[model samples]
Each structure stands twice: as C-alpha cells, then as structure tokens.
Target: MLYPIFEYFDQVLDIPGTGVFRYISFRAGMAALVSLIITITFGKNIINWIRNKQIGETVRDLGLEGQNEKKGTPTMGGLMIMAGIIIPTLLFANINNIYIILLLITTVWLGGIGFLDDYIKVFRKNKEGLAGRFKIIGQIVIGIVVGATLYFHEGVVVREFTNPVSIEQGMVETPAFKDVKTMKTTIPFMKDNELNYEKIFGFLGDSATPIFYILIVIFIVTAVSNGANITDGIDGLAAGTSAIIGLTIAIFAYISGNAIFSQYLNVFFIPNSGELVIFCAAFVGACVGFLWYNSYPAQVFMGDTGSLMLGGVIAVLSFALRKELLIPVLCGIFVIENASVIIQVSYFKYTKKKYGEGRRVFLMSPLHHHYQKKNIHEAKIVTRFWILGILLAIITLATLKLR
Candidate 1:
C-alpha cells in the first residue's frame, strides 16, 4: 500500500528518499526487518495471552526426555508469524500484483485452516482436531483455486527462451513483448529443462492440453502442501528447514524475475516475479522469528496454524516461480518425512494383512521422532536437520548451473 505513496512522493513531489522503495531488494529488506520487529515485539504478548487462557499444548507421554515438561508451554504462536508476514507485505509490496495477491490469499486461507484445527484441539479438547478429510478438502480447495487462477489469470505468464550450441541466438523479440505462456513447469537434471503438461495428451491436439495441464498443477500443489504439513511434527524442524528452503527459492525468484539475469542464465524470465522476493523475505523473517520461541525447549508450538500455511506458501511460491520440481531436493526434509509416513503405513497394512498385528518401520513416522526415540537430543536433531536443509538448498541452487 505504501508503494504508491512512495512512488508519488518520489516522482511527483521529488522526495529523494522515496525512490529507494522502487528497488525489489530494498523493499525485500524492509519487509524482512518489519517482519522481524513484528514477531519479536508481539510474540511476548501473545505468549502471555496463550498462557492466561491456558491454551497450552496437551502432550501425551511421548516417552522422549523433556517431552511432558513442554505440556503446558504456550501454543499457536503462528498467529505472530502470520501477522508478521502479512503486515510487512502490505506495507512494502505492490498489493495490486497478482503474485502478491495470490501469496497473501494462500497465507491467510491455509493459515485459517490451521488456526481452526488448533482451536478445535485446544478449546474443544478434540485430539483429532478438524478431521483429516476436512484438511484434505481445504488443501484441495486451495489447490484448485491456485491452479485455476494460475491457468486462467492473464497476468500470470512466463517468458521463455532458447539456447544454441553452434552460435549465440537472439531472444525472440518481435512485439518487444516477451512470450506470455501457460504450460508445464521446469524439470531438473534435464538438458532442456522444459516439461509441458500439455504433452501428456498430444493425441487430442490442442483441446486436451488445458485439461491435463491444470490437473497437473493441482496435484503438485496438494502434494507439496500436505508434505510440508506432515513434516511439522518436531519443534523448530519445519520452521528451520523452511527458512533455508525459502532463502534458496528467494534467490531463484530474484534471478528468474530479473530480465537481464534470466537472459544471461538462458532460463525463463518471468516478469513481475521479482515482487516475490519481498514476500519471501517476509517469509524468512517470520520463520526465523518464530524459531526464537520455537527452539528446543520450545516456549510455544505453532500447531496446524503455522505448519499448513508454511507448507502452502512454499508450494505456491515454488509453483509461481516454475520451481515446483525442485521441491524433492529443496524440501528434502519434508519429502523424507512424507515418504517415511507413506512407507510406514503401507508396510504396516501389508504386514497386518499377512500377520496378526501391524508392524513398525522406523521407531516412529515423520522421520524426526525416529531419532528422538534413540535418545537423540531434540536440539541436536533440529540442528542436524537444519544442516541437511542447508545442504539441500545448496544442491538446489547448483541445479540452475549444473544443467
């Protein structure tokens, strides 16, 4: 909102300082600083409120050391993270931009789902809080909305280019306007890196292209969001890992959005995507600040309030930037956590069919608890996971050049 005011002041009133807001980096930095301030300041007040209302996390005897001791620590501090991200974005970003609008919507929409689940568990005393079906429904609804808009929205498009082995080629420049195309996204470890979903139904010609392409995006959105949600089982694990992933994505978004950088790299140059940097900056700030209270011996649990939104935001941002394929690598932690659950359950069902009881796979699912059960300190586990997240982030960045 303040963007326009800064523009007016800079251009019309000739205010010297207002022009700095024009730079994406400047706005991104401002957003991060603002998010940090909001989290650190309001975090304490919310903690007190949660404690006053006895809105503490109910811990079953998880059998881990210091597990039950955290039974009454505050919960739902994700509200602080939400506020931190939203307010900064509104203040520092171009609110009219479609990407920003979609991000804000996803942030609030999935966040509301998580907050409701947390509320049900805390207030209604329902251990099952918002049935799994409902959560799936909410995620699917979001996926559909995001998928439809991304496919149908005219403002959303990518400017692709070609490379040459024999000679340097000029960018397709006819109308001085770049190619605004809606199709499949990029795939890693490939030569050309392009993978259009429309190709799935080439037999039907142009008619089936839109049908299959939209479904592909919807599937990707749902899968990534749920993957991140389930990965939130341990304190500071998801947040810490998400921060690292967000930083890498933020770098990719920066280069992808900048016309010159994208051309130099011979990659898709998405106009208006630079604005995403500010949103990601806010994301990193919110996650880091939440980590202050979310660290081992956590003062508060983010619950579904933080987890679902975090995952959704990551998914949407990756999709928006055509980096969804990088999720398995960038979000390796979430991917492993997700796969562990799938494997554990699938094996249990298989074993139960053959034997009398369901058997176990790692001490527990979600992967983190497996180590937690082996007397691994929560802090140590979280730290190592963060290291792995960093490792994955670096590997993901290398993909931009490796191919």
Candidate 2:
C-alpha cells in the first residue's frame, strides 16, 4: 500500500528523503520494526480478549512436570502474529508482487485452517480438532496453488547464462544472461548445486513434470506444517525455532534476489524475490515478539494457528528463493521432533504385532517430551533446543559458500 505512495512522493512530488523507501533493506527494517511493535504492544489486548471469551488451552494430564499449570492460559494468540505479518507487509512491501501475493495467501490459508482446528478444540470441546485428513487436504490445496503459480508464472524466472558461467569463469564483467522459467532448484553442498526436476520426472514425459513438481510441493508444505504443529508441544519451541529459520531464509532471499551477490556466490538468481526479504523480516519479528509471552511460564499460547502458518510460510519462502532443498538442515529441530513421533508410533506398532506388547523408543514421543520425561525442566529443554536450532541455522547459512 505504501510502496506506490512513496514512489509518487519520490518521483512526482519530489519529496526529500522519500527515496529511501525504494531500498528493500530500508523497507524490510521498517516492516520488522512495525511487526515487532504490533505483536508486542497489541498482544496483551488480544490475549485479554481471548481469555475473556474463555478461549484457553485444555491440557491433558501428560505426567510431565509443570504441564498442568499451562491450562487456562489464553490460546490462539496467533491472531497477534497474523496481524503483525500482514499489516506490515501491506504497508511496506509491494503488494502486487506475485511472490508476496502467494505468501499472503499461504499465511491466510494455513492460518484459517489452524484457527478452525483451535476453534473445534476450544469451542466445540473436541480434543480431536479438525480431522487429520481434512488438514492434509487443506495443506495439499495450498501446495498445489503455490507450486502451480511458481511453475506457470512468467514473472517467476531464474537468470541463466547462455554459456556456463561460474565464479571461476570471472563474473567481474557483465555476462549475457536470460530469465527463463524452469524446474531447477538449489541443492546444498554440491559445486553445481542446481537440480532440475526434469532429471527425476523426465521419464514420465514433459507433461507429467508439473504434476510431480506440484506433488513434491504438496509433500513439503504438509511435512513442514505438521512438523511445526507437533513441535509446538513445548512453550517457545516452535516460535523460537521458527524465528531462527525465518532469519536464515530471509538471508537466502536477499542474496538470491541480488544479481551481484548471486553471481559472486554462484547461487540461483531469482528476479523480484527481494520483496520476500521484507515478508520474512516481518515473520521473524512476529515470532520473536510472540516469544515474549510464549516463552516459559507463558501467559498465552499460539496454538496451531501460529505453528501451522509459520511452517507453511517457511516452506513457501524456500520454494520462492529456490532453497527448498535446505529445509532438512535448516529445520532440523522440526524434523527431529516429527521423526521422534513417527519412530515411536512405528516402533510401537511393530513391537505390538510381534510380541503382543507395546514397546517404547523414547520415554515419550516428541523429543521435547522425552526430555521432560527425563525430569529436565521445560525451560532447560526449550533453551537447549533453541541452541541446537541456532547451530543448524549457521550450517544452513554456510551452504551459501560451503558448496
């Protein structure tokens, strides 16, 4: 909204200092500041409203220390996060950018799905909120939309040289480059890091490539979203980890969108994706701001609303920045948390079938809960997990040069 107004001010009105808004870094900083202000300042009021409406968390007796104390805390504080991200983006980002459009849609789409799940749990008194199948379907729908848009949109193109150009080839001088739409994505830790989807799906013929790409997109969106949801078991785990991941993605967006940096780093150069840096800035700020109340001894919980949206947006940004392949490393915490659950469930089923007695892997399912089961304080577990998340983030950033 404000992008065009600032443009008019700089161009038509010739307003002094208005030209600063033309810089992505300036706008991104403003967006992050605004998001932090909104989430922190108005968060209390939103929490009060939710609490007044009797929208609180209902904790099951999980036999974990201090678990019962969390019951009745205001839930659905994700409203604050959503407002923090959307309002700032509208005010500071180019709303017409297709990448921005898809991100906004993903935020609303996944947020709405999570809201419904929380609503069912709180209002309808159904512990099993929103059938699992339905949630997967919603995720698949958004994945298809994002995948199809990136696949078909003309504006979504990567800059490629007619002759193979590399850092070794000397990018000090401008080289002939053309923007073309393709299914190539960045694969970390390889010298020639680009992976074309055609190499894997070409056997099915050209027409089937889009289908396979969309299917991969759907899988990523669903997996990460569910990973975050399950990781939300402990306070500050999801939001804090998400903040780290978002910052890493924002760096990728900035580097990929800048031609000079892309050439120097030998990374995929995506046109017009710099706008995503602003979106990701808002995301990181919102998560950090929410952590104020979402941390240990929380006053409010983000519930599924914030968790699902965070994961979905991260997945979409990775795709937009061509860094989707780095998700396993960057999102290692979410992956491990998700894997713990799957491993436990699978192992339990196998043991039950063979020995007619259920066996356990960890003391509990998700890794955090296992720590809690080991008598580790939730705050200590959260802190350790956050430290691990930071380490993973650094590794993720190192991929920009490590390859």
Best candidate (score: TM-score): 2
As for candidate 2, its clashing pairs are none
The Cα error of candidate 1 at residue 237, in Å, is 0.7
- Residue-by-residue lDDT tens digits, candidate 1, 1-403: 9999999999999987888989999999999999988888788888899899999998877787778788887888889889888999999999999999999999999999999999999999998899989988888888878877887788888875444222227754432345666666888877799887667687788767766665766676667777778877678888898889888889998999986677667667887899999999999999998888888778888888888898889989998998888888998888898899999999999999999799989888778888988989888998999999999999998888888
Predict model 1's lDDT versus the native: 0.85
Cα lDDT for residue 229, candidate 2: 91
Please give the TM-score that candidate 2 achieves against the real structure. 0.97
Candidate 2, residues 84-158: lDDT per residue as tens digits?
A: 999999999999999999999999999999999999999999999999999999999999999999999999999
Question: Worst 10-residue stretch by lDDT in candidate 2?
Answer: 164-173
Alpha carbon lDDT at 305, candidate 1: 89
